[model samples]
Target: MSDTTPRIETERLVLRVPRIEDFERYAELLADEEACRFIGGHMPRPAAWRRFLQMPGAWAVQGFAMFSVIEKSSGLWLGQLGPWQPDGWPGTEVGWALHRDAWGKGYAYEGAAAAIDWAFAHLGWTEVIHCIDADNAASQALARRLGSRVLRQSGMPAPYEHVVVDVWGQSREDWQVRRSTRA
Candidate 1:
């Protein structure tokens, strides 16, 4: 993790901004057909390279973006999750995509919880959404686990205009209530 980048540590994961060292694994994750299925489909190296750059660009330009989720024990790149608000987005979002190897380990939920807190506390976001594909029941379950319900159905922009997604979210007030209850 870069000292300059913002980071959040959970019990078993480290969420931090995308660094140059992360590209290989990021590209690998993007290339896995099963893993990338719901996340705009698996791409070749060239396309993966372009897609991989988006996170760092978002961090550098927008001052916030998905963090590279690292396993605390293995120090491995497990996934990405955090604040994301691109042009034509459905809403302020805390999105996630994990390497298949990391699935079922609860990393996405763990990282996203921290990301949501960071977005609400540091970014001053009023609400946060997850643009989940209809067929992705795993993500749907994760969204529910995060205390977000389906706020609406929405279409994407430009290259993804043909794809529609469920906007799952909760307000800052709702999240605070959930957090307090969990405590």
Candidate 2:
């Protein structure tokens, strides 16, 4: 709740920095096979622990990273989504992943839209991309819902270079126009 810490509130969600208490549900999400199918395969708790720290580390060092998506009503960690750009990454990416129980709720779309807005305004990003697997219809549809289109087909950086991805995105100018129309 510090003046410096970034926190975003939507109609039913809270996007905030990763806290130690969120690791349990974060581990659960990472270990869910179906929920994580396209993002990355399931991992054991030990491995999940390693991956779980990345978000907080990113926020501290880079001053930005995927946010912990929280269900405001229930105080639950829904998932992670927001600004991300790792070494050798394809582009400035706004990615998301939610637990299976949270599906069909439009939380991803809701959270992602807000994230995109924040990245452009706060992060000063000219463009944002969502690296989606070709078969990942869910993410693809979500990207479309956010008004992103497939800009190119590209391979990721080391470790993930093998995974084929369709980079979907829209420029900040497009986002501003889109937002104006909605208003």
Clashing pairs for predicted structure model 2, backbone only: none
Write the residue-wise lDDT of candidate 1 on 19-74 in tens digits: 77888888889889999999899989899888888998888888999999999998
TM-score of candidate 1 relative to the true fold: 0.97
Q: For model 2, how does the per-residue alpha-carbon lDDT over 1-183 read when each residue is reduced to its tens digit?
A: 246889999999999998889899988998899888987789999999999888888888889999999999999988999999988899999999898889989999999999999999999999999999999999999999899999999998877778889999999999899989998
Clashing pairs in 1: none
Best by lDDT: 1
What would the TM-score be for candidate 2 when compared with the true structure? 0.97
Query: How well does each candidate superpose onto the true structure, as a TM-score?
Result: 0.97, 0.97
Q: Alpha carbon lDDT of residue 122, candidate 1?
A: 92
Model 2, position 119: C-alpha lDDT score: 94
Candidate 1 residue 104 C-alpha distance from true site, Å: 0.3
